[model samples]
Target: MSRRSLLRGFSGLGTAGALAALTGCGVPAAYVEAGDRSAADRSARDKSLVFANWPLYIDTDDKNTSKRPTLDAFSKRSGISVKYTEEINDNDEFFGKISPALMNHQETGRDLIVISDWMAARFVRLGWVQEMDRAKQPNVAKYLDPQLSSPAFDKGRLHSVPWQSGITGIAYNKKRLGREIKHTSELWEPSLKGKVTLLSGLDEAFALLMQGDGVDITRWTADDFHRMCDQVEKYVKNKQIRRFTGNDYIKDLSTGDVLACQAYSGDVIQLQADNPDIEFVVPEEGAELWAESMMIPNLARHKSNAEKLIDYYYEPEVAAELAAWVNYVCPVPAAREVLASSKDKDTAELAEDPLIFPDDAMRKRLAIARDITSGERVEFAKRWNAIVGL
Candidate 1:
């Protein structure tokens, strides 16, 4: 069995809605007031943190459903009990759920939360999340990936830290295709007509497609967008593309109903565990490196405990445990060595998997595409949804 992040369903709804809703605004009047933003330090009183995140994100022991080893260890080590809640299924939906409280300068009741970095960009931009005290997070400061540092939205990652990072690339069945795919452009070959799928969301799809056309996604232009849109629209017209898809592409690809598609690195990793013939490729042109990040919401009551929990995960041993189970790109490079030295053979082999722990060469080719700005979100989504019919 393979596990997948709910990227297509929840992320699509939230991202599409979020981008469309937030535009040309300095900060909406609904934003949390600066003066009312800080909640009194409640760590001394509570000694517990509430964390909201996506389902199946953390490592869970197979035998025991309730016990989460890493989190339990954190609780025991720090004497801080964690109230973990898998409440964040979609970025936009979670924002809708919590924004009302934030806008009114009230605690959302969740001390910590995780959402895709693109959405994290919005929260950071709106000052909805607080700056972490780097003095307390030495492990995160030292172990965080260099490429992930200094995002345009959160320079130096003062407001957010990546919980897990992954890549957006092409995943294809090698036995079905009968050849290795080295570049994204090859998905358009005549043999693949009506058999290839792209992601449905504009943010998820545009970067890789643009990269296939030889654009540097880190600094792609509006013109670059329209050019790619023109190409995709043409492909749709000719039925060269099977259809725009969400995470559903995983099922289609696995069943040999679709040969290849735009996919997340984490999903492909699990896919390979069951179907070894399935291969994920970082195309010669490149792929987008993305992260689902952690942020402390404005006026969150257990802020200090939450910060402690965030740094706890950054410890190399803990990070290695997470990387072993979730199989995303490990944000802590030092954790690779920890996994490599593991006593468990299956766990140790994971350290060598390029998809899980991308080597320097692969890292050089992986770029975090610049996020779609609030100003461009509406126009871009309109054009994108028009073509994809989402």
Candidate 2:
């Protein structure tokens, strides 16, 4: 089904029913904007596209680490100098850095930026980003993942494009667990006490936890949230969870400090290369599908150039190059063919990896969570922080 229709289906639910449904389920509800689309100032000169992304996200030439051949080729072919910068270390910190600029009607010194969708929702809600002109991006409209087209955050192609996708699943060191864990409930079993970890970031963590109780995350309600909170309180009281973390969860899982913990499919792919014993599971209940999306910030001086750069990456060859290096979920449907053609057995094998292509079996177990809106942030953070003692 089209993403819009799927989300619209849930719009019919009453608030309480939705919450009750979401309590312990993994599916996230659809987000509908409560107001009109924010208008953008369209009269601006265009040339260079300044891009802000997370560290190590793009494909770099192996021998020449400084060069991103795919992006460089785009610059040469399209005559667009991409002023790409790696400045997004933490979500909140990056938000703080750019909030003043966005609030004061100044340029964010970036034409495009990549951020997690939950954070992307905040920008979209506040009208901090420019609406993309899809006519200029036929590649995106044609090739982008249909499931991600109308996210709970951006109902239409009004704001962002998913740069890559991943799942929040259970990752465990099989050697440490001495048994395979196939579901979320396994983490809560007494044997795993103090041997598991959760993501500290509220957005990064919650949906999967909610899933353990069988709460349908798509239509989760306040009561469901509270119940999940209460359960986490118990885990905290017993010190069953080692601590909440970010990428550090990889470190703990690798060193055997954590037997099983919430993990991103992309990171686990890389982690497995170093330690084959590390395994990822989409718990029987369900898992959250998340992505870091690319958007044009408001008041960018190079909108056309930026659009060109984005379209370049949409090409299957370019997308495959990126998918090969970064090891995240590939958004371009056609890239799977490119990966399969690779003479390198490792690259060809990646084409068969469910984490990358996400076979129907894995897709069935995945859902995107409800994004915390600007108004909801403070209250959500407060409640979540109390649980993690952040």
The number of the candidate with the highest TM-score is 1
Each model's TM-score? 0.95, 0.87
Per-residue C-alpha lDDT of model 1 across residues 286-331, encoded as one tens digit per residue: 9999998999988888888888899999999999999898889989
> How many clashes in each candidate?
0, 17
Candidate 2 local Cα displacement, residue 185, angstroms: 1.0
1-390: candidate 2 lDDT, tens digit per residue: 111101111111122233334443643332323232232433244446679988788878879978998888987887667778978765556766776566556688788898878778877766778777889888898888776778877888578988888888889999878999988878888999999888776777789988888988777777777888888888889998888776777778888889999888887888888899999999889999888889887777777777777887888888888888888888887899999999999999989998888888888888888775545556666788778766
Query: Lowest-lDDT window of 10 residues in candidate 2?
Result: 1-10
Name the regions of candidate 2 deviating beyond 4 angstroms: 1-46
lDDT of 1 at 28: 45
